[model samples]
Target: MNEQEESNKKQKTSNESTEFLNFDYEFPLDAANVIPPENSSIPEDLFTFVTDINDIAPEPPLEIVTRINSQRQQQQRQRQQQQNKPIVPPNQGVYTIIVGGKPFRLSWESLKSDGPSNFFIEYFKKKKTRVMQIDRDPDIFELIVRHLRGYYIRSTDDIQNQSLLYDATYFGLNRLKKLLQEYSYLNVGGRVFRLPWTLFQKDGTHNFFTGPLMHSLLSPHTEEGNSPPIYIDRDPDIFADIVNHLRGYTIHIRDEMHRKNLLKDAQYYVLRQLSDKLLTAQQTVAGFGEGSNAEVLLLLQDVRIVNMLPPKVTNLSIPNMLISQDWSLTQIQYKRVKDGTPHTLLVQVSDLCMQIHKSAATVKLMYEMNHADIKKMNSMANMAKATRGVNMEIYIDKYCAITIDDNQVKSIEYCMENDLIDTNWEACTKCDLEDCQMSRLILQRAICGVHLVDNMITLCALRLEAISSRFRLNLKREFLSG
Candidate 1:
């Protein structure tokens, strides 16, 4: 119906042989033949054509058809590629996780704990049985301390081994342990696992964190007064996991506390040897009202503080009789006062005995001491300073005059003046040492003795480890029998 159609109609009419006076001398070809074709090499070309676009709607562009077919092929290929790709697996629960093109690390545990706290307690009991087999390998404690320091301290910080670590272990016994334990405070598994990771070591190996930092519990009680027994919430997984984690001791935070505890306890023993009296609470919670509501009370917080930064300097208080009985050493106690009032603290111990003992005394006194002699004692006097106090320098002197610094000589003379003879100090005269051995002294004790003998702590027989082991063995035997 358009102009093109009208033009085509006119063309058709013009080509047809019609009876009309169209034009004079016009060359008209035959209706059936536009071109002369025999074999028709150009048959298609010979025909003058009138064609439509598509069969369905008159005709369509050749390019459009090709484009549609190509699109369909691309979609098919996309499906095939998806099917060919393989999937990657996932790593289980740990510190790290990844998902949806993003990577993340996760370390979490269920806080809502249920069940008898004793189950974990009992499990801890069972796990401690392993300690019985560990012999007194003094090297282990050093390794443990190194391991702990590796994690606990940075080079930027000067970590006081006695102040931060052993102090917590000897807390109630020496009070420092309790002070340190305050920092060990942690919230675990909903149950408020009130543990003294810093102050008390679980059964003495070096694994402090893995050890039961504290039993997740409140004080024992019942709803009614006359009831024989009572109960609280209960779920086994939390207690079980608690048990499992603690029982399977590791050299992580848990075990580190444990070793620190052993050392702390040993430190206390050293104090006791020095004739220090340990203060004990009456356990009657009159001030706190009823049943030791003070269960897990910060027992050693008020415990006195001392200047433990020294070479056998004693700030621990002692009873006169105890001192007379064990005169080889002394204890001077100080009340811990915050803003002047006494902080409810009272325990006695030799500060940092383990760390001090761990150092090489001969090297400390002879070779290392020479470093200090660079000026006063001459070049020949080798000295190495003590790690505890920065200003504390030791040096061996050729003249034996200045090297035996009056301050050092004063301390030695003061102890010797009071009959402080330790037969074990290789540095001391045999007569002086024999006299010390004859007297009741700190060296007469365990780790102190080891310090004098081999320069190490023999923690194999620490009391807490024995107690925990005993508790565990008893529980296991009871469980088996039941």
Candidate 2:
């Protein structure tokens, strides 16, 4: 070899050795098969015929095998931990509750904060478990859940309202019960009706259940089960018409008698708007005869008589009187006043007259009382209490009107403000106290009668021509306004 060639060969070998030292090395999974060097003489032909890599490969070291097994075991343990991990993390305040066979995943924080310390909170406090089970109607429970989320339940359906109310009661959610306002069931007569309180409230007729009746309906009963229905003492058939009217449904009026009965029912329930509607309907179809004289249809006969006691009027029993086909008394209550004064008596009668007049606009009521009238009233009452049999002096008035002489009705004082009977007369022998001073009052303006069959009497226009004219005038006014 020349000097320059040998120097190049040495430089090449040095560069290769440097590269091998700088290279990154890692152990391979399969060891490469190596043939024996030229100096080894025993394995040349054997390696030439050997094709399988496993035959030439050496057995792995025990340390490597042990490390591989340990790695597999660690991997298996990690998989088991993943499989056993909880669905809801323990740190998060979340839980799953099954209600009525349906699962609900809800946050404990939401249930605690949103609800008003009610059943949900109380239940969780008592049972501190991650999962809970409650056997209740899921459909109704969904409503309760929404309610807890502060959603206003706008369900106007009477049945749905009743269900929600029942659930709220069952869950001991008082606030939820109040949120569903004015929903109730009424057992009116023998028939049961589901109705909303808003029906009455909407028409501004909530006064129908103002006093004791409303109290009874609202007061809670501790007895287990569904809420008791409110009972109303009224004819179901007639009340059905009222229900229809309130629900904005049209009711077919059969005839004058039907209309009259409906009006009476409306007045009894204090449905002023309904009464007005009935009156308007009647006026629209009213007819009159050719002249002022028309046959009168007397409504009530054989009315039980009640004499109004003088001075301290303990009780003013207003009887159920049907004066004409169009006017009748549906409800009347007489409150006895302990104040034995004529003024108090006058106030009560005035109130009764006003209430009746407000009920039906077609009828007019006027009362008269004087010193002689007071004596006559007391004497009649005394006679009624004393005698069990029929009294000859006590007479029952018929349907026809009776004319009074001028001498009998001396001077008639007209008091405009009082609106009741003129109670400004001198004291009588029976009523000698200062408060028992009697006055003269003329009850009827067009006709006068001593015995009117009952304690109270209502008078309307005697002539049909007058009624027809009045009705026509009202129609004209309404039409013009419209």
Candidate 3:
């Protein structure tokens, strides 16, 4: 009875211990992190066969996950609210400013002196002693403080400059506002821009002296911050186009006026590549080819010079003689005309010649009787009319060439890339009357008898008609010459 009873009691106790250790629900196993103690009785192969916890265990129920996330969010919101609470400074002279959930302690005297625009001054007028709270960026507010303390704020980025400017305006910092307007990186016609400083300092391969001129315009902001903008008077829209060109962007000009305006700015700034491009565009618009290769020849025959000045000398007529190309014919009707003023006769001649060299393009040609040459001719005009059948020849290079077709000028070649052809007025003063007279004296030759004709106007008109007909016939042959 004693042995059976003892065995049964022992079995009951072991059963009780096993039942205490076991539960109705299974505890989840973390296979990856689970490690066995060295003295553990568990088999090593049990761990080897273990799978990843995610693979073995299912995720928590959706409601439980949602509730947990909600609790976490609420905790974060509480922390943020605590952080946003206004901070009070301990010192009497210092005031605390809460900005963007950050506290800044500034001197009350400094705020009163430099900051605290009308907004803050009203609060001060109420004599309320409370921490200030602003709904602005704390980083930019620091810049405002720096500016109030008379520190130079060299803002090279447009965004940063704008942020600081907004804060300055809210604070009613008049000095800072003015400085920001003036000392901004670039101010083009009241349009403020803060590009990378290196852009203005950088030299371009296509433009001539662009960087230096633009650089000279933008003065660095001094500690006082009162520097005026260099391009305050310039056109912002055109300047924007220039900026695009500088930034390696292909900018399309909308119309001819825009191109012309930009060209003017480019020329003023000495942007040679841009100017050349615009000039070529101008020629293209005028219906002339990119580069004219045509040559022009002008000839004057049976030339006559007559003096209409008061008779102070022996003769009032110069005989028919070969005249220099530089010698402009004296006005037949007027005693004296201004140099640039269009002479009726010269204008008639130019129009007749242009008609002969007619094309689709507007030919830029001009003929004018020089007043200086007329006066000098008057000095020599008081002489006998010597008749020797004088003839004069004048040549102008590439004056009337028309663009062949649109296909030829599809792509514009910039002058910067190519050598510019010398397109200046060329004249040969070989047959000067004064020089010819001197030569005659040196050679001791007798001059030919003068043939003076009072009705010279009719003869000149007839000669012009003959010359126009000749030009019309030879127009093709003349323009085709290289």
Candidate 4:
């Protein structure tokens, strides 16, 4: 163990340390399989240090550099060309359109943006011709051309309106179609009913009113004018109700007569929804629950009794009758006892008549009964008696009096003989009262055994009975005296 031995040993240890620290760790084909060294004193910065591969640059071929520079120049030229390209104004160009043997000059810019216009423009451009033929109505084409020129159209004729719509559809003029649909109005029975075009063109089943309206709006013969209205042959009031419904408003039909008319018109027009609405309205106004027949018949009986009264009597009014229960005979019977006389009794009858007439519901009921079918009336009468203990005889007798005028007795007899009364009562009932002499002679010859005065008395009695029943009256004493 000498100085030489110690130095040699130290040198061997230093060499081993250098070899371990320099560890030429090549990235293995499967680096995941490499095992980490247990422990080492190598500085962390030395392990993280990266070599500058970019510092060792190699010269590229001249041909490759030339090709790359050429591509860059080509892209620069393209960008300059794009920036310098010309912009054509929309209104700058002109085009010719041949529609229905007529040539129309249109703006190319205007035609280029629209469906039909664009189609024709492209067609002409492809054919390299300025003149393109369109097999559309010249008038309709003119309208489209005007619209393209920013002119609004207002049409009233059904044929022209329809043709315009057709042309719009063919040409794909949605804005024009929408304009026409938005502005169409109807003139029905001398009354104008305006509605939104969308309502008539809704994509489903339509009512009688809308069907005709749509047809009229779309008919080729339909004319276009300045805010023109399509003429319809229909009752104005009923048409108004239909229009209200289409407009999404709640139908507020107050009068039963109006309701009936609306119902009839709805049926005629095949407005199923409106018909359903009117039917519901009828039931509601009649105060009859759904499917209840007896109360309706009873109301009809009351109506018949009221209709029998003379027009003068029906028009009379009794103030406070609706609020005052004392007006009933039960309350007034004892009061009238001391004042008993023919005059007093007549006054009481007059008051009772006024009370009945003053009731709007009662008046409506009476009108319904007056116009009710004869056979239907008889059936309703029978039904009423069976269901509600109503006296059908009273209703029958009233109907005979009010409906059968003395002057028209001859006509009535003729109608009965010919069975025309069953078919058309309105025609049979309408008679010339001024021709009384002729009517009286005819009545005497035709209805020899019919006593007109007795029938009148019976009709009066039936009415009195109704008044008594309605007001809960104990009018037996006054009624007997009258």
Candidate 5:
């Protein structure tokens, strides 16, 4: 009731109004829950019940819902795109081609894109099968696959090239065929000889291209390229002549060296017909000045008769006896002997004096005596006269004759008496020796008769000796006597 109490109440009211103006203002929970003027400064303990609660759920914002709707539209559009897309087969990426009963996996896109592989692509498209069967060798297919993959094929083996050609033709792979056709070019000693395959179709027997030479050139084992050409270890000129012959060109080799080299190549490559032709040509050329009637007298020392035939003979004449020194027939004289006989002789003689003389009719001398053997016989006769105290003389005349019919000897008649052997002895002492001489002469006549009919005759000297022994006389005694 006093003035001082009134003043204090007024002062308190002014301080409270100043504090209300300075504090941050927040909207009331409701108009009824307003703070009372009496309790303007609320106690911190009274608001302890208003603690934060994290468990209560709240509705999503409108912006979040709009974004979720946009995401749903995007998903729907993606699904539509998936449904509208073209259906691709599971095996479309890869193709399985069966060759030689084996599966070969390849890219479908690559097969379809390749020009040569169109046939396979069309076939695969026509048949929707997963596996396509093809009848082809697996090894060849491997090569084809390599070629398809853009690898350069450099195989030069003839067999492999032939196989590849067959496959290429079947598959319509013109590129591979062209490559094979191009292989006919031969690289002989840095010289490029382009020989077409068709050029060798003539006379398949003599054609080097059609025969083993072609096989060697195209052999797959041989590496082929521009840097390292297919090497031929032969004379280039000789090979050129061979190529010319293969190309249906008449090969007239004027150079003897070239001919000799060519002959060697021909023999090596098994070009038998070509070898024969070359030999005949060489023989004709070598015997040009020599008369046609001039006989080829082959005095064979250690040479085989068969080895002296055409091709071998040609080789012999080249570069001065290319075959062997023992086969030298140039030293033998080819002149008609004593009588005016119209016969050219080919005699094969050895130191044993067994003469194989071939003329119009073959005359083979089974037993012949040289001057030394005659002297030996004469000495033996002289020794017999001195030691045995028996005067014995034996002489062999030069001229003798025998008759032959078929392969068997019909008769042996000497041109003169004791033409082969002449002996002077008593009837009883010379009986055995005379019988042996007669038997030996008959055997010699038989051998000559057999040789007359047949070019070759096999006569055993042991059998003749046995026959002579059966006559109660040894063949050695007969030889000593004459």
Candidate 6:
């Protein structure tokens, strides 16, 4: 197809989209509601119940809305606004518009759907372009934009109005300049400013480098003083969405880490038990029972923790690669005693990593001990700076001991026998884990399994953050000095 033909085809599609969505919009009078508090990230154990591919749920519903337009009395005379404001940028419109294939509207709505459109109309009066393309519906855009303006004002007013927070300009939207002038969010020096969807794309997909008015918007998570959910005017529903998404991601990662932890622990239990079993077999060889040498020989064929993932993932078998003279009779004897794999497979434990290995056996590490190892490993993790956080096992095992310094190792292995009820190890509730992690580990007894999960999750978060270039830079000086 030629250029004009392709243009005609594209226009036909655009026209169809516009025709499908156009509708009358009511102008709202009231300001938008300030957002609710931010939510925590997703949990790790959320997908534990799911076992097969059939267990996965379906996709969520997508919002399909219409643009809305309404006429209302002016809030202020148009001439008064023209004198104070700068000329509107070429990229923006005084009223709603369609620029570069995306919808861009400037309408407002009150708490109710049909309310006054006065402030919205007046606000758009002094701008350069005042085009609003007709679409299937106009109400949705008006309402959504009205809410966006309100959020922009609420989140940015402090910085815009020259409060002590003026330096904290990492969250405001860049297109609407008046928000900062009238409200508190400043227009300049904002690090992470969100742009309209229309500006965020070229061919279609969001442009990472050039789309955002400010670079930080694309990288908001690490931006300093970015109270993101607060600034983004996060819906409580979005938190739920985030939790859902995070659970999928975290579960995959957490389950992997946890499985390794559990398997290692399970394997350790199996091996240790098998070691005991081996000791029994050895005693049989030394002791002279009916199956004496036979029992010892039989055990060489027994499956141990060191040999597998688990019954859930896989069931391991004695490798043909391993065999011996005593082992041959042992295999035959073990097969004689059991119909399936040995139960000693789950008895391996970490405390006996050496004993089982030297006995021509293998051991899996304990999860509890592994958690301690992760804490220690993370402390020794390659980092550009020093950091501390709550350790989960320490929380369950030692009451959420805070690591005051890099050398704070005693907290992880604190004796449950001695430390429970010890007044020194408890984490305070106020810090929300953050404050609790920075303080000294006061030994106390308040061990809980859920707290163990939370502490370990907190540990993962800390490990991630400790090496995070952002966190490392923020805490580097102290880390270096110590």
Tens digit of lDDT per residue, candidate 1, span 349-430? 2211111011121221111223422232221111112222222212112112110111223232234445433323333232
The lDDT of each candidate is: 0.27, 0.47, 0.43, 0.44, 0.46, 0.29
> What is residue 93's positional error in candidate 1, in angstroms?
31
Tens digits of per-residue lDDT for model 4 on 302-351?
22221121211211222221212211111100011112211101100112
lDDT of 2 by residue, 389-451 (tens): 211121112242322222222112222233322233444344324344333322222311122
Provide C-alpha RMSD values for all models, in order: 26.0, 22.3, 24.6, 21.7, 23.1, 39.2
Order of models, best TM-score first:
2, 4, 5, 3, 1, 6
Question: Backbone clashes per model, in order?
Answer: 61, 5, 2, 14, 8, 48
State TM-scores per candidate: 0.17, 0.37, 0.29, 0.36, 0.29, 0.16
lDDT tens per residue, model 5, 383-427: 222222211111111221222111222112232133332222122
- By lDDT, the better pick of 2 and 6 is 2
What overall lDDT, based on C-alpha atoms, would model 1 receive against the true structure? 0.27
| The 10-residue segment with the lowest total lDDT in model 3 | 437-446
User: Which structure is stronger by lDDT: 4 or 6?
Assistant: 4
Q: Alpha carbon lDDT of residue 96, candidate 6? A: 55
The true-versus-predicted C-alpha distance at residue 68 of model 4, in Å, is: 28
- For candidate 2, the TM-score is 0.37
Q: Tell me the spans in candidate 6 whose CA falls farther than 4 Å from its real position.
A: 1-94, 102-105, 108-126, 132-146, 149-482
lDDT of 5: 0.46
